[model samples]
Target: ITVEEGLEEEEITLPPLLIQPYVENAVIHGLAKKAGGGTVAVHFQRDNGALAVTVRDNGLGFRQEEGQAPSIRHSSVGMTITQKRLELLGSA
Candidate 1:
């Protein structure tokens, strides 16, 4: 896991578990599937007036079924809850 903070000295606070699921998925589904393992890179930066968080992994990606929601396709309950929370916070 590599975290890159582009904000320099700026400090930021995120809602708990907001990005945890993505990292969990990356490890459980991405790196765990590969024979040699892979890296997960998480980037945090200021994009315009908002905070940008990106989680990336170099592992085999999954295929989604037709008309399936991403959270459902990935079977990520935490992600689904996080999406709902974001929607409620008017950030989605």
Candidate 2:
């Protein structure tokens, strides 16, 4: 896991756990499946007036399971909940 911050001296605040699930997914689903392991790179930057975060992994990409619901497919429950929480806070 590597974190690269490009925010410089700017400071921003986000709701708790806004980014954890993605990182967790990258590690558990992405890197964990590879035989020799891989890297998870998290980049944070300030683009225009908004904060941008990018999580990249060299693991196998996602494939949807058959018979899964559209809303839940390819997404963990924690991610769904975090999205909802962000929506409620008007930050998503």
Candidate 3:
């Protein structure tokens, strides 16, 4: 759970607004797929002069357009929101 290095650190760049929703989706839908509990890891750093944040989980992966299990729809929303946010941020 690497969050902003510091709120006041001028060198820290905040990700575009939609990032939160994408993260929420990964936890809700992605990790939730695991039978037992799972770990969600997130990292933030400066990569090649650009900010890079990644969310990862150990859970069942999916294929394009594949319907998620019924219990997983709630989580998928987050990913969807994140994608939209990135698009709006012109980062897509």
Candidate 4:
């Protein structure tokens, strides 16, 4: 796991847990199932007056599953919560 921060603004405030779910997803779902494991790269960039976070992993890409898996459900929960949080923050 590698974290790269390239923020144009030195000090920026962020809401709680805004970026953690994505980083966790990158590790848990993306890199954990690889043959010899893989790299999870997280980048934080400030663009204009907003923040852009990217979580990238070099691992096995998506494959078709027969049915809904537990991991899929877990991911959905995390993403759903994160999406709502983003919406709330945006409205604030």
Candidate 5:
């Protein structure tokens, strides 16, 4: 895994949990199943006092063939929880 932080790190404010779930998903759900190992990249930048974070990976992405079912392990609840956390942080 790699992390890239932009120059604006000291000037921006961010929630503690903002970047964890994405990075976890990138590893646990995105890259772990690939035949060969892959890389996970976490990027953070500050834009106008806001912190921008990204987690990316080169891995076996979600793909299902015809008559195939989607993976049961994938769920949208993590993202939903993250969104709610952000909303709560914003309102605080």
Candidate 6:
């Protein structure tokens, strides 16, 4: 995890909580789909007035057409929850 400091004077804003789960899912479940190990990159930066966090994995990515089942351990909760959480944040 990467952390930035020197923000006490600035406001403390947080990304949607569901996004947290999305990140975890990407690292855990996404990598499991791959045969061997892969790298998971997480980028944290300030964009305009908001914080931007990007989670990327080199593992096998998902394709919607597959309609594959969600991992029993991980579920598809990350995607579903993250999307809804982002929507709520937009309204706020």
Which numbered prediction scores highest in lDDT against the true structure?
Answer: 1
Tell me the lDDT of model 6 at 60. 69
Instruction: Name the lDDT of candidate 4.
Output: 0.67
Q: Per-residue alpha-carbon lDDT of model 3 for 8-58, expressed as tens digits?
A: 346555565645765666676677657886877877666676667788777
lDDT of 2 by residue, 21-84 (tens): 9888878877775799999887777777777778888876665664432233464598789889
Which is superior by TM-score, 3 or 6? 3
List TM-scores for all candidates, in order.
Answer: 0.75, 0.73, 0.59, 0.69, 0.67, 0.57
| lDDT (tens digit, per residue) of candidate 6 on 22-92 | 56777676787678778877666666757766788776676676654254333466677667777887922
- Model 2, residue pairs in steric clash: none
Candidate 5 lDDT over 1-92, as tens digits, reads 33345464455466677678877777777777777878888776655655666788887676555221236343457766888888877832
User: Local error of candidate 2 at 35, Å?
Assistant: 0.9
What's the CA RMSD of model 1 in angstroms? 3.9
Q: Candidate 4 — which residues are off by over 4 angstroms?
A: 1-9, 63-75
Clashes of each: 0, 0, 1, 0, 0, 0
Of the two candidates 3 and 5, the one with more favorable lDDT, higher being better, is 5
TM-score-sorted candidate list, best first: 1, 2, 4, 5, 3, 6
Cα distance off (Å), candidate 6, residue 58: 1.2
Cα lDDT for residue 33, model 2? 59
By lDDT, rank the candidates, best first: 1, 2, 4, 5, 3, 6
Better of 4 and 5 by TM-score: 4
Question: lDDT for every model?
Answer: 0.74, 0.72, 0.65, 0.67, 0.66, 0.64
The parts of candidate 5 lying over 4 Å away from their true place are 1-6, 63-76
Give, for candidate 4, the lowest lDDT window spanning 10 residues: 66-75
